[model samples]
Each structure stands twice: as structure tokens, then as C-alpha cells.
Target: MAIWNSRFKKSFDKSALKFSSSIDIDGKLFNEDIDGSKAHVKMLMKQKIVSTSDGNSILKALEEIRNEISNGKLKFDWQKEDIHSLIEERLVEKIGERGKRLHTARSRNDQIALDERLYLRNEIKNLLKLISDFQKVLQKCLDALPEQWNMCVKLKYLTEKSGEEICQELNIAPTNYWQIVHRAKLQLRNCVENNWFKN
Candidate 1:
């Protein structure tokens, strides 16, 4: 049954339930949802909002649900309005009455926000990792260059020096400087394609 079922005189239409449901989309938020719930449950316990025993039961069941979802032993149902309701429904089934207490002090709406923020945080961390890996690959390509080419590339690109300035600093003719830069770029592109992008 839907959480708001009590307010209605008639049962919800199956098609409308399917139409209004976000389980297909927010089902991706299982990890964030479980993590946020676990933290919320702990906070409730600490503040004496729920008994420690009930909190422990809810936490244990939540981890079990997480593992079940991770191992594909559990499947999400489309009947639930969203991931929060689906998870809470599973929680209630696992631990009976105590699982209901897991929702204390916060609404499912709050869980939705928390899960989204956590998902974004995890995505940002992953993005940072990709950026870090790209920098490492660039450094490897840079390190493979001939010493003079490395210096010319760095002066021309890293320090934003003009072509004339880089040639003067490296004591190379302007024509030679351009050739060095061209070769360096080709090597960098080939190295990156072979080492990173090819895969």
C-alpha cells in the first residue's frame, strides 16, 4: 500500500501507481539511501528519539538489505512511489514493528534530498579521480619527452611564454622551436591515445 493510502477512499489505480512511481529512476540511489538512513538512525538513537535496541535492529536490517541489493538477491518493485518507500517497506518486512521507527524525526522527502546530495558527492569524487588520473597520464607523457623538448613545451605552454621568449630562453632558433613543439605535441597525443584513450 502507498504511504498516503489512509487518506483515500478507494485503492490506487495500478496504472497511476506506475505513472507516479520514481522507483525506476531513484532505484539507482540505493547506496546513498541506505547510507543516509543508517546515519539518521544512529543520530536518532544518540538523541534518545528511539531505543538503542530498535535502532540496532533497524541498522542490521538496513545493512542486510544493502547486501541483498548489492548481491542481486533482492529486486526493486515498481509499486513503491520511490526508493525511500521501497527501502522502508523492505525494512518493515525484515524487522516488523521496529523498522517503522527508522523513519522517525525525518520524512521520506528528507531521505530523497540526502540521497541526491550523497550521490552528487560520490560523483564529484569520481570526477576528481578521473581528473587526477588524466594529470598522471599527462605527466608520464611529459616525462618521456627529450629534455630540450620538455623545457620548450613547458615554457611555451605551462608558463604561457611567447614563441620568441621560449626560443630565447632555450637558446634555439625560432624554426627549431616550432619543430620541437610540433614533435612534442605529436608524441603527447600518440602517448595519451595509446596509454589512456585507446582503452
Candidate 2:
């Protein structure tokens, strides 16, 4: 029986249940769900919505469940409609009545939204960091160029133009073009070795 089956007289049809299930879409939210539940339980305790003893038990069980999932000791059940239900079921199994109290103040909509926001906020932070690092590398590579060599390096590698194409674009003769390309390559190589790839 579902954790929410109390109001319904009969179980949902299997096909209907699968259609409404969010387990597949929200499966990646296991950790976020546990985190949100823990925060809710903590708030419940602070607000006296639930006793400290019950709150402590719920948090401990959640931590254990998180570890179990991380270590592959627990496998999520796809039959559960979503991570919220799966975790609530596990919590109840672990600490019985205390586990049921974790959801005291929040609806499923609020809980899921909080978890998703937390997850997306963390992901956005990581993406920003990656983009910042990439920008730094690009700056370092560009700064490595000698003032006069900068144009040649940018043309040859940054813009991905061949030596002959760069010469044509820059209106330089082949002889001078090859010389600039050679010096630019050497400068870029040393710069990368020093600024990026060195020990």
C-alpha cells in the first residue's frame, strides 16, 4: 500500500499508477529529497511542531538512508511514485512512528520544489565555476602571446585558420607569414607549458 493510500478505497490500476508515477523523472532527486526532509524535520523541532526526540530519530534515519544509497546498499523501488514516497516508506520502516512525523508541516509540492531548487542551485554554482575556469585559461593563453605575435596566434589557432589562409586574410607574403607562424607557435608552446601544463 502507498503511504498516501489512507484516503483511497482502492489501489490505482497498474497502468494508471505507472502513468502518474514520477519515479523515473525524479529518481535523481534521492539525495535532495533526503536533504529537504532533514531540513523540514529540523524546522519542525525548532518550531515545536514535532518533539526533539522524534526529529533526531528522523534525521538519523535519513542520514543512514543517504549513506545506504550512496554505497549502493539500497536500491530505489521504481514502483514508488517518486523519491518522496520511497524515502517516507523507508523512514517509517526504520523508526516506525517517528519517521511519519518528518512531514508534519510541509506538503509534497513544497518539499519537491525545495529539493529541486536546492539541486539546481548547486548545479548552477558548479557550472559557473567551470565557466570561470575556462575563461581564465583562455585569458592566460591570450596573454601568453607577444604583442606583435598576438595577431598571428589568434589567426592561426584561435580563429582556426590555416597558415596560408591567415596569410591571405592578413595580406602578408608566404615567407613572412611562415616566420610569424613559427615564432607564434614557439611562444604559445612555452606559455602553455609554463602557465597551464607545467609541474
Candidate 3:
């Protein structure tokens, strides 16, 4: 029976367990789940909720589990329902009674939500780094061009200002604006082909 089965009179149906299980979706979040648990254990120690010796033991075991998973030495049992329960089970197996105290003031809903937020926070940091790198490349492309063409490219493509807005700001007519932008595009095309796509 699952860890929470004591609340029910009989064992839950296998089909119901399979249908309600979130292991498939939440398995990939193992790292986030472990990190959150580590934080929770530390807080429990701070508030005198769990003894320091137990907290230390839990942290040590969590680190071992993380390394085991990373090195392909650990395979989680998907039948456990979700990553949270899986980690808790493994922790208990490692440290006996201390593992049970890791969940003192936390709930499944809050744990899952915290893991998802941590995952998204990491993804956002990666995307921001990628954007910053692309911007540097774009600046290099613009800097290699003539002064007028560079300004037109920055205003039109980089700043994303409309033709009318750029023309008004640059004190140029609409027709003149299009002509400059057209020439700038052609120059950029050639520049990219020669510098970025050379055969």
C-alpha cells in the first residue's frame, strides 16, 4: 500500500491509482523537488521543529539521491504517484524515523507548486541568457554597416518602431524612409550570408 493508504479502509483500485498518478509529469522535476525538501528541512531545524541531527542526516541523504539520479544509478519507482512521495519514501528508507519529519508543515499542493515555480524560474534564466547572447550578435551585425544604414536597422528592426514613427523622428519623408530601410535590409542580407553562412 502507498504511504497515505492508512486513511482509507481498503486498498485503492489499481486503475484509480494509475489514473490519479502524476509521476509521469512530475518525474522530470526530481531536482526541484529535492531542493525544496532540503530548504524545508533547514527551516524545520531553524524553528526547532525537527532536531539538527535529523536535519543533517536528511540533507546528506538528499544529496546522495540527487547524485545517484544524475549519474544514472537511481531509477525511481513510478508506482509511487509523484516525485514528492518518491523522495519521501527514499528518505525514510535512508534515515528511518527522521525522514517522516521532513514534511512537518508542508502539504502536497504547496510542494508541487513550489517545484513548478523553481523549474520555471530556472527556464527563464536560461532564456534570458540566450536573448542576451543573440543581442550581442545583432549589435555586431549593425556595427559592421554604414552610419545611416546602422541607424535605420536599429530604429526599424531592433527598436521595432514603425516606418512613420522612425521617419518622423529622423526628420525624413515616408518614401525616403522605405528606401533607406530597403537598402539596409539588402546590406544586412549580404553581410549575414558572407559572415554567418559562408560555405
Report lDDT (CA) for all predictions: 0.90, 0.81, 0.84
Instruction: List pairs with backbone clashes in candidate 3.
Output: none
TM-score of each: 0.75, 0.69, 0.70
lDDT of 1 by residue, 1-199 (tens): 6788799999888999888888889889999999999999999999999999999999999999999989988787888788788888899999998998887889868888899999999999999999999999999999999999999988888897899988888899999999999999999999999888976
Report residue 23 deviation for candidate 1 (angstroms).
4.0
Q: What would the per-residue lDDT of candidate 2 be over residues 119-175, giving only the tens digit for each residue?
A: 898989999997787668657777867655678777776686788887787788889
Ordered list by TM-score, greatest first: 1, 3, 2
Give the top-scoring candidate (lDDT): 1
lDDT of 1 at 129: 95
Clashes of each: 0, 0, 0
Model 3 C-alpha lDDT per residue in residues 79-118, reported as the tens digit of each score: 7887788878888888898888888999878888999999
Off by over 4 Å in 2: 1-9, 140-199
Once fitted onto the true fold, the runs of candidate 3 whose alpha carbons sit more than 4 angstroms away are 1-19, 146-148, 158-199
